[model samples]
Target: MIGEFAKRQGVKKVYGIVSDYQVGRDMWASLKADMESKGIAIAGIDFTPIGTKDYAILLDKAMKSGADGLALIVVGGDTVTSLKQGGDVGLASKMKVMGTMLMDETQGQSVGAGGALGVHSTLRYHFTQDTPRNKRFVAAYRAKYGELPSQYAGEAYDGMSWWLDVVESTGVWDKEKWVDAFRNSVRNDSVEGAKRMRACDNQAEQVGLFGTAVAGGAGQPPVTMKVTETFTAQDLFKPCQ
Candidate 1:
């Protein structure tokens, strides 16, 4: 989706940050291949070694690389650190920024006020989405966890629950049968607002919310986004042909 968005926007070059970890390296390679196949060029690639505490220098290199956009794929503590430093260096204003599913409200707060505002990325769900399944999921999650669930938690919960449901219903771990059943399942009953899960990619497709970072209420922390619109999976994703 990121590649398609960049391509559609006439961006000739894309920049990305990857961690030195195995998974991060692998994902970066995949994204590079995808972008190249679409005729987009990778302007620059920066790999920050794992456990690197200071990102000021790294951000400097990335910003000076002359790329038009930035995609941050690192997660958890590393993501927070990068956002803080990225904001400090005015990277967001200088370049279009997008993040992975891990860029949540908590991380947005660290980016400071208006840091990630208007930054667009794909997601499985958002707290502001309205749906019966979502309502039930939210209610149940708060009831169980004593707090509101983020998209990550909701997606994880839904994926695991769906898998469990299939396993229990079929009473066997037949991988092929489970795979087929999952592909054909129209799981409108998701707590994460997913309409269905694609067994082929093992990814759930659903309406995604786009949001901008905004100041939280008085005396509250910064928020990641103010809901802009509900985008269908098909709308956000362009089929590769």
Candidate 2:
């Protein structure tokens, strides 16, 4: 999706850097295949093992790849360390960077302002979502938990809401009725926006977001992820179930 996003931005080529885990390898492979179909060549690819520290060689190759964009497929502490090192080496100015498992507040703080600026990420939720339902949920969550809600919180709320609605309308929570209720309902007023559980796959079809990480001032987390695009349910690609 990041490659597709880059192509939409008119980027013709990109380098892919992923960690040496099976998950990272699979992600890069998928990206390479997708970009090829779109006429966007992957200029180069590399993998970093877990706990690997130095990125100077990888950064050098990335700068030399002549690609104007990058696909990063690493997670957790590696995400922070690599972004910081990539920034230190001027990779951000030289290329448009996109990645998985990013735009997190904790990672942003570790990456800092200079390191995180211009990094783009796609994610399921962000606490700063401006929709009215989201705003109310965030306010209530903060009041109760003394912290911003995560995607887990959103998932819990959506799950319970769906069941409650089902129980209210039918007054029978039998297996057949429960399944029917979920499949038939359209939850337009969800905190995350309009959603419908796909009858074919039983997955909630809702909006995903693309965001840029920016520095937040005092009293807030060190970094704040702000949404730039709201990808509708129909915009998501679903496979045969």
Candidate 3:
């Protein structure tokens, strides 16, 4: 979806910057292949160490390489640092910034107000998303915890809720039987909406949201993501689905 977004924005060249790790390498490889397949040129793929504090040289290299965008493939703290540095040096003006699994609400807050504008990322959930189901969940969660639930917290809550319900329905103490029940009985109605566990793999097949981070004012989270597209897990799974 990030690649698709770049194409939509007329970006023709991408420079991949990622953490020097297995996860980062794999993701960068996937992005590079996808972009190239779509006829978008990959100027280069560069790996930065986990604790990189200075992205000036890296950004300069990407700019000099003539990349129209920077494809970030790192998450958490490393992602935050690189994004802030990218913003600091006005990298966004030169090239689009985007990545996968990097720009969630917490990371957006870390990016601070107006810092992550035009930064695109893929996500499964966002607090600002407006839906009857999501609204109810957010209200209940904020009431209980005095704050909005992060995506991880929401996932954990949904998992427990589904498990308890499935177990109650099964009315069984047998471990094997319960596993089977869980595997088969996971057409769960979650805050994000209806989702079903793939019976073959027992992985919850949920919808994915692709979005771009936008600036939010004071008293709100540092940034908010505007959903640009949605895709089904089944559509992605293909043969498995």
Candidate 4:
């Protein structure tokens, strides 16, 4: 999603800042592959140790890289710190910034709408998803928990719901039977939209959502996510190897 969006935005070059770890290394590699496949130059890449608060040097390096896009591939508290400091240095303003999991409801609230505005990322589930099912899910979640659901919470609910449905409908109590049922299930009514289990790899194939942080409208929360584009499962998922 980040690579495609960057290409559309006419970004010919990009710089990346990622965590110095296995997951972050994999993410950086994926981003690099995607961008290079689209003919975008990788001006520079930096891997910062997790929990590194000061981004003066890294941010300065990115600024001087002559890149039109920045890929941020950090998570957890690192996400908050990098984004806050990135804002201070006007990085987002200077380049098109893309994140792996940036500015969701929790992070957006922490960064505030001002800091998160215009930042884009690919999301599987977001509270701002506008649909009757998602609206009900969000409302029920907020009513019960006093807060919106994140992607983690949403996936848990969906997975649990599928399990129960399979058990009830098939009257299967065997663990293997349950697993098989799940492997064959197709959930068209998920809060995040339609998804189906790819039995070959047991991977869930679902729609991909590209979202951006935008200030809330009237009666909305201080920070809200706006889905700018939606990718079909076919457009997103790779074939099972």
Question: Model 1 off-target regions past 4 Å?
Answer: 8-12, 37-39, 109-120, 140-147, 167-184, 192-194, 197-211, 217-221, 227-241
Q: Lowest lDDT 10-mer window, candidate 4?
A: 216-225
Estimate, for each residue in 1-241, the C-alpha lDDT of model 4 and write its tens digit. 7887787778999999999999999988988999899999999999999989898788889989998888988878888888888888777788888887777666788986556877888776777766677889888998998866886687688778877887777786688888888899898777777779999999889878778888878755677778887878887778887
- Per-residue CA lDDT of model 3 for 102-208, tens digit only, reads 67667877876455877888876776666676788889988898877776777777788888888888787888887888887745467677777777887877777
lDDT of each: 0.68, 0.79, 0.77, 0.82
**Which candidate leads the pack in TM-score?**
4
In model 3, what is the error at residue 228, expressed in angstroms?
A: 2.3
Give lDDT for model 1: 0.68
> Model 4: residues >4 Å from true position, as ranges?
145-148
What digit string (tens of lDDT, one per residue) describes model 1 on residues 1-241? Answer: 6665556556667788888789988888888898788887887888887666888877776678787777677766787777777767677777767655635665566655544554655565665567777788878877897766776776787778887787677677798888777776766667645567565665666666545456666433456556544556896554433
Where does the lowest 10-residue lDDT sum fall in candidate 2? Answer: 232-241
Query: Higher TM-score: candidate 2 or 4?
Result: 4
Candidate order by TM-score, decreasing, is: 4, 3, 2, 1
Report the alpha-carbon TM-score of model 4 versus the true structure: 0.91
Give one digit per residue, the lDDT tens place, for model 2 in 65-111. Answer: 89988887787777878889988876677888888656566567788
